[model samples]
Target chain A: MARTAGSHAETTGPKVRAVALRLFARYGYAAVSMRQIAAEVGVQAGALYNYTPDKQGLLMSLMQGHMHDILEARQATSSEGDAVQQLEAFVKFHIGFHLARPEALFVSYMELRNLEPQNFARIEALRRDYENELEGILARGAAEGVFTLDDPKISTLAIISMLNGVVNWFRPDGRLGLGDVEQIYWGMVRRAVGAAE
Target chain B: MARTAGSHAETTGPKVRAVALRLFARYGYAAVSMRQIAAEVGVQAGALYNYTPDKQGLLMSLMQGHMHDILEARQATSSEGDAVQQLEAFVKFHIGFHLARPEALFVSYMELRNLEPQNFARIEALRRDYENELEGILARGAAEGVFTLDDPKISTLAIISMLNGVVNWFRPDGRLGLGDVEQIYWGMVRRAVGAAE
Candidate 1:
């Protein structure tokens, strides 16, 4: 009996999160309920509690998971180059990572207002850490005289926002492949930062 | 009595929209109900139908209204200048207009998925029209050899996305004033297209 429950929970935990994310992304977070999430997960409402304490907990977990995933993915990529190369890697990584997880990206951006203050701060910190990575690249480039920037911090936000906009309209089977899109953006980014050719 | 009723609706119409926009921005559209909107508008639930056919209509109207407002605002701005000057106006106008109406911008972006298909199409057409305005400038600039771009269409989306990001974190009281932010972004925009100095 104990072994069965343990295995069930291991499987069910992921199921609960998946269902919850879909429902929340489809409908706004406030519009989704724990009971509804449970129904979608094929579990009793009581069983959901065994996986997540409540809706807020589930939201925080999803957001935090997204942040951590992106940060980890960013960490795994090569950062062993000059500022221009580092900036290129950052741009490509950001676009590819965000494109692959549209739902998580949507939820993370859209549901920010719903996060409780404490949860908001935690998520913001993680986000800042991510932003800081790009800012660091810009700063290094500016310092090395390879790139000209009025404000590295503002440039960081502008570059990320421009890249994030890709997920809004990019289709994998569209006329342009991902590589083409990345190259186009990198060209613009390189120019935008006044990077040396 | 008819005149009085007409006048009442004229006054109440904007209120209903204002309340709905605020509520929808605060809570996702699905989580907000017609009754909640009516209550906030200080009217009976059924009376909201007089203002809007249903919750969807309200959402559609808000999104449509936002698009029209921006389009009209863009039209009002002077498009008379060299391509570089026109692009500068666009970047500055975009950031200022969007920043001034954060709630509308937020709802317009976040509730796009919630728009009914027909409504979505209408809003998209308007958005595309807005995008084309920028594309025209880029095309002109490229043709005139004032700006270099790999793809004018892609560059248009990228520039607008970068500018639209200002609303996400810009504060009037923050370290940068609107003018300072605009100038910084303008510099980046000019460089991003490889415009002649």
Candidate 2:
């Protein structure tokens, strides 16, 4: 529940995690010191100890938060639909999630090494859980003869790879709008899975 | 040249660039110092200047070199073939290029902002050239009625996005061999284009 932005118990855990995420993204995690985070939050260095034991814990909390949101977002967005519908919902939610939260993207990919081995593997497994969700969807689609694929697992990775890529090249002010981006990704996903428009 | 481990430079350049790239990747471009690079390369700080005018220039050169290789790989591998063949070649080439040379991958994504505005745009344009090549292939495939794509440009980005993602999860000792990974990627690309298996 506690995070590393500042030790001030008055600050909410999520708020502290947000601050630390932005800082870690801008400045690499190792480059930023605990004192700097305390300064940013207007709290005493000793105060941050109340929230997080160390910088690594803060990173773990931040990553886990993001991974968990992704899981919840997919679960929340998905409905009683077939494979394509579920996959579409997942893709839309994924792009929307990362685009809306660049700080989370930074923390998940950039600060993984900062997590202790046990914590790092834990979050990594959670992240893989999202992948598994997609894989299951692909398998169902293929099994139902709605989607065609030689190998469902590899196909799922390819789809996720392309979908996850939106965060790297997409810009809010860029030439394309969000809806178009979603449609574009869906179109590609369909093609990748041998589904027709 | 005396570039550091995993530098993109050929033999023609000086050693400073190599040392700097290796150091920057290890310690981050912002965290590394010109003196440290000089020390690594067994040269005095003053002598390092004779090779690169400044740290920014060194960073830009590395970026430029990476972009050049990417563009070159796109050109070299994507020639004298039909759209489908060219695209398959392109995808496999992309995986091979990136995996075989992590240096380019590290610079293109990790050390992007270190470039000066003018230099940065130059590198970006090279990347765009590669993207355009993919777009052209997809568009051609669609036009030939061999492929189905709603948006060639976005599909190109989507596929490349998936391809670039190999960096985050790929491990040589893993169960899947590199060839298997390439086959998986190619299969996805083919399906995504709506090409027959």
Candidate 3:
């Protein structure tokens, strides 16, 4: 049955989004249900409709919303600097930003297909923007002759590939600290970008 | 209700696994189920049990079995060479092997968590061994200074990351041929591990 304004105010829209993000990260989008989300959030499945019209809406909110916020955050923090600092900020942000929200990273990365075609296109554009962010940085560094790579597209794809790989194996309780993780990835990124002196 | 089988051949163990892989690749592991798999394989849900015990077993078989076969294929065709040649061969194998069997790659990489603890550990070990294959090459190259990496583990990890990222985007129908894909990746890999000329 469809729900209307009968839902309670104690459960806000953002709370529903947070719950959905965590569940999608754990169980994936298709594997999760309105009932499961409601059960975990202490609301009725119909109450979830108070926030999202459907599960696909929840996934779209999780991905496109999170990515938009990420792009905004990176934009706000970005500064004009020497190519190295710009690159460092980009690298650090890529690593630190993802570490701060593993759920968002995992779910957004894993659940692209669950979106409606129009929604998928929007989310894909946001992700492509994120990819292009570093491509610009690499192109700037390369144009200055400080960086040496044959093709920025291949190099950009490669650097992103290496950086994104960090999420798969990173562990806070493991021997490495987050700073160490950043530095190690930064080191390799430096080499790959021909930034190391 | 459980399925009753007349003979061992009546069990759809292998057939179910095959169908699961194809569907998991095309749709996704999370979106698939025993019923869907059964429907595709032309078997009843009850008949699925003859092949394996449960959904998790089917996922494990797709993963552990796939990795076993991948390792075997590599062992057969994998050549002995200095770290550079071995690395190229590994890159070629990684791309060729995955491009050929996207279904297996999709299931193994995506459905890892679906495995029970023992099953997860066993498949993880196989993954570690595969990782170690690249690590061995990196370690050899680092020792000879053919690879000027600050950390072999990072190089190993990064190489695998770049290679695996191919599956997320590569399409046979794309303008880039398999050989073109291999060449592009090899150029990046060569620069990554090439002797400091």
Candidate 4:
């Protein structure tokens, strides 16, 4: 009986998170209640506590999980080659990953202000780690004379900001296919970083 | 007596807007209430309605006012230069304008989802107008061979998105002054659009 209960919890846990993410993305985090999340997950409000401690924990878990998944997915991509190649890979990977998870991307940026101080710090650290990955590529490129940049840190931020905009407007039925959009952005990013062709 | 009443309303109207902007930026629009805004404005909840019809009206007013002010400010700047010069002016202007009014910028993006469908459409139209201003510059630049871009529309969005990021992290007393930040961004924008020497 205990094993069956544990198995049930394991299946229900992900459903709670999925519902929470969608609701939080549609309505800002401050406005969403744990009761509402539980309702959407087809569970009683009391059962939500068994899955997560509270609303804050739900938010932190969703955000931290997103960052972890992003980093893990990035690692799975083929990152072989020079800084230029790696930067291109980073750009393409970021656009594709974020495009597929628009809800997560939206909530990630929109709800950062709602995280508790400690939770905010932890999330920021995780984000900084992801950013530093691209900064490393720019630094490597600049060192090898393959790219010219005044500040790798600012460039990293600028490039990511530019890429993040894709989620705001890209649609599957848009005139430009994903490949076309990626190509255009890749060109602009390469130029922005002053890559030597 | 009527003149005095008119004068009082003129002052109170802006106060109401200022308070609403601050609260909405701190807490997402969905979470803030009319009572809270009125309390912050130091007026009775009913008095708040005299300034704006409802919460939707207030949100729409703030967003529309922001876009109108942006377009008007852009017009006030010297836009008579060539495409490259114009793009540089845009980069500097956007960064300065948005950085100075971080609250409005924050509310503008974060609360966009909370706007009613009609209000959202109107605000988007106004925003598109501002974007087209930049797109016009890029199109002209491409025509004159002063810039190389596959799509002027995408480049306009990319550049604006990148410049918008300055407000996210910029501080008045940071290591980089406003002028320094502008110069660095100008360099990147110039490169991103593929401006020729």
Candidate 1: list runs displaced more than 4 Å.
Answer: A1-7, A33-36, A44-46, B1-7, B35-40, B43-46
Per-residue lDDT of A192 in model 4: 88
How would the candidate models be sorted by DockQ, starting from the highest?
A: 4, 1, 2, 3
Q: Which stretches of candidate 3 lie over 4 Å from their true place?
A: A1-12, A82-85, A142-145, B1-15
Writing each residue's lDDT as its tens digit, candidate 1 over B1-197 gives 12344448888899999999999988778778888987887777888888888789999999999999999999999788899999889999998888788889878888988888898899989999999999999999999999989999889889888888888889879999989898999999999999866
Best-matching candidate per TM-score: 4
lDDT of 1 by residue, A128-148 (tens): 999999999999999989998
User: Which 10 successive residues of model 4 chain B have the least lDDT summed?
Assistant: B1-10
lDDT of 3 at A95: 89
* TM-score of candidate 4's A chain against the true A chain: 0.91
Clashes of each: 0, 12, 1, 0
For the candidates in turn, chain A alone yields TM-scores of 0.92, 0.87, 0.91, 0.91
> Against the native chain B, what TM-score does each candidate's chain B reach?
0.90, 0.85, 0.89, 0.92
Worst 10 residues of 2 chain A by lDDT: A1-10
Instruction: Please identify which of the two predictions, 1 or 2, would achieve the higher lDDT against the true structure.
Output: 1
Using Cα atoms, each model's DockQ against the true complex is: 0.67, 0.47, 0.43, 0.69
Please list the C-alpha lDDT of all candidates, in the order they appear. 0.88, 0.77, 0.80, 0.88
Candidate 4 lDDT tens digits, A75-103: 88989999999999999899889988988
Which scores greater on TM-score, model 2 or model 3? Answer: 3
Calculate each model's fnat, 2 decimals: 0.77, 0.66, 0.34, 0.71
TM accuracy, model 1: 0.90
Please tell me what DockQ candidate 1 reaches: 0.67
TM-score of each candidate? 0.90, 0.80, 0.87, 0.92
Best by DockQ: 4
